[model samples]
Target: MNRIDGGFGWVIVCSAFMTLMLVDGVLFTLGILYIEFLDEFKEGKGKTAWITSLIPGTMLTVGLGFGGIFLSTLVCVGHHFEKRRSFAMGISLSGSGVGIFVFAPVVRILIEEYGWRGTLLIEAGFILNIIVCGAFFRPMQKQSGRTTEKSETKEEAIDLLRCDDNLIYIKENCIPSDKNCTIEENASQDDDVHASKQEIITQTKSTKNTTLSFFSRHFDFGLLTNPIFTIFVVSNCCTCLGFNAPYVYLPDRAEEKGMNKLDSAFLLSVIGISNTFGRILFGWIADRKGVNRLLLYGTSLVICGTVNVMNPLNDSKIYLMIYASVYGMFIGVFVSLNAVILVDLLGLERLNKALGLLMMFQGIATFIGPPLCGKSYVYNLY
Candidate 1:
């Protein structure tokens, strides 16, 4: 940690942010292309739906698994500094929201002027931003502090001098008040020795209970053992189950109500605009007004939005627009609440592991949510 406070870390952050934004933008906008391919390829029912659905499957399932396994290592980067941790996380987190802000209009305009194929090409370019971002993501280089041979020798002498008076005693035996203490003194007097013994015992027990692999810590089921943690996980899973479907299907719904394709595309941009506002305003309210209560209010808004969406007031364009705007606000709240709620539940120390696992499970929902909802819509229509 002492060796890493320098220029290269920030460079890595910027590069990683750019690349992640591109990949994430592609994932978010896949829904828009689902309908396009459905029409263009003349696919029927479930087959046509796979285009958008398939993409996120790779992201959610594969990406999440890898993230969970490596999260312990990945989260270590933030441990070196106290002040920069939140700022670093917030900076990274804000990328997805920023991606939404940047790409929403671009998608709208491209789909408006050219078509879906053009939009995919544009999304591909956005994905390439990963490369740009990756360039800056260099591993932290060790910056050793300056030390001459004389200073090194002096430090060693000082350490020896400090140790001379700090004699350690066993339960029944007295040790010398100098560096000449024996293994018997270590066994009796040293807390570090006791700690090491305990650690060895723990590893032995763990090995007895589980298989013997070098990377024996292959999984962490300790997270799911907590009841409150389990409940939040389930709630988030259900939330994702219904949440993304509406956004993905909204354009189609608008068009079904006799809106033009261009207008339908524009509606998504409007939602993004409203979502940006929703995160900022509601995030502030959550902090000031109580995060839990504010979250309940947001969840209530989601329920209301869902019910509003089910309305047959399709002919009333103003009512439809109003619903869309409100839905955007509700979803924005939902998205922001995701991390905040996890932090509230788990606290900062375990947040990365909790989030990694939470999102891995949520990824299952993300992968399955839209398609299941889409399929249900078809089945209900029949």
Candidate 2:
């Protein structure tokens, strides 16, 4: 079959980019959703909060960890064109950046105009776009060069084998014909060689298949059996555990501290803005300074940010803003670093599975972290 360059390939790339952008934009819009959810569902806070929480919590819990399945699928889907793979991924990732830029202002406007209920519907509409774009994602197919060559060679050999009667000797060498050869006799001999080559190829492939396949194989208890991997998994989970709580609670906390609505909203924006910068900065750092150092630095920052929660000087608005900024910076850096560090330790081949496993743990944290923190703050308020 002829290769399809002009048909589905470009469409698939466009779809992947839009899908990621839409998915991530909704993910980032969680802060807006959480506020609306809290006010709307104050009587059933715990249960309803889960509705707002499920996506990121699932995404972080499932998306980050198991998200490699999609990542690998993307690689396999786009693998045929060597030149386009990086371009495709770059385009896809750019969705997050674009989503953030678009979502910030759009969300601000929607909240101003329609309030939370309308904002929720708009965000839902954005996420639904992923489904529309995803429909266009068909895998690229390359022409089967090996199968074509093998078929042609087999046909030529068969034709030559049938060229003579004393063909046994001729089949052994596949010499076209001699005076001593007959077509029928030589044909059987040629079959033996053809079968032998096919058998060798099959045997080689079977032997090589002994190694584990797919990213998930690494998670098959070997890493779990190791003390170090277990420690890393647990520590990373703890780090992620308390990580997003502050972001969810920052606006509410600002209001509690006697900051006006505009300032509280600005505080939320500061976190979002800082978070975008943190992801970029730490992504670069993780690639260069080693993921381990970035992890340590990021975790320490989270600890510091958490400690700032009990700041004795809660009366200082300027100080509080700085603290929130630093906290956002640290958490954002840590979140990005978590992926790189896990991938680095696990190595690229096994990274996705390992992260998927890690996210299962983080998902639990996502479910528990915010409410627990929020309730505690509420208790103190009373």
Candidate 3:
């Protein structure tokens, strides 16, 4: 059901926006949680960080942000608009920035008042709204057109592309047999109906099996056969190694450098606010003629890396704020066009599978990145 720059499409954009806000809000404020965990558990930073790493898939608390709402939102936007996809993606994903802005200070205060465990419970409440947004992710609608089958012998021919109880919708609208037009003299419509029903059941079971395998084991290995895809995947893997470390450690680092917890958490808000503007600005720029999305993405990533590397030059709050703003803007550009750049490289047909595979790699990098950052921070501390 593609409306393609239509009215309801904006509704979907809004849903995506809110979804990201909740998902990333919980995920990005881990720094607030990090301080609490250390104070409560009396654990070393490296070991404590493995706790943060466990939240995504293992813990019920951080699990809200973990279920790939981030990827799913992008895929949902992909289904609706084409020409303005970059712009739509920007708006939807900018919710991450919004989440960071709203959640960081809130989480810090909650931890200070409620304890980390209490804070986790309330944060869980914040994340559950993602389910409400999930309602707006309308499924693809069938194309409308009338077709007469070559089968005067058949009552109905159904191309059952997919049939599942969870998503109960149907294409191939049934047309009743006309009063004057009958099948052959002896033919029974009842037999055809029964056959069609059996076929549908068979396809439904097959679809279930195929979908399970597709999510788990099946992928178009052919996509990896392309040299360009291989290079792209490897390059992204490299880029992601340093990407997530800062978020997990930034607030804690600020606190260590003698800033109060509130001020440290506010740094994430600065990053988030800057990130929001960056997503919008870069997304709009990508829409203009002659703009190279790949080049823009690469440049932004390079700049972000530079900022991350240079962040430790001073303990000054103003300098840290400047660093946060610069890093957040480029981070926005990277995310805004991430899938857009992929579409240019791989086209829409392959996006769903391609993105899943891409995220699998990036997720590995994300999980490894922060803990390794913790190890470095631990080393530097001693």
Number of the top TM-score candidate: 3
Tens-digit lDDT track of model 3 for 330-381: 9998778878878889998888778777776666666666677788777994
Question: What lDDT score is found at residue 328 in candidate 1?
Answer: 65
| Candidate 1 vs. true structure, TM-score | 0.66
lDDT of 2 by residue, 193-243 (tens): 333444656787986676555434544546687676688777766665566
Q: What is the model-wide C-alpha lDDT for candidate 1?
A: 0.57
- Alpha carbon lDDT of each predicted model: 0.57, 0.57, 0.78
Report the Cα RMSD per candidate.
8.4, 9.3, 7.2
- Tell me which of candidates 1 and 3 scores higher on lDDT: 3
lDDT of 1 by residue, 1-382 (tens): 2334234445544543454445545555555666677778986645665566566554545554223322332343343323343334334444444565466557767876889877777666655545454444434456555446446545545443333233422321232233233355434444333234346567888877766442235434588999988987887787767666655776677778888776665566565556656655665566553346345645755665565556554556676667666766666666555555665667766766676677677777876877777677778841
lDDT of 3: 0.78
Root-mean-square deviation of candidate 3 = 7.2
* Cα RMSD for predicted model 2: 9.3
Off by more than 4 A, model 3: 56-65, 145-218
Q: How would the candidate models be sorted by TM-score, starting from the highest? A: 3, 1, 2
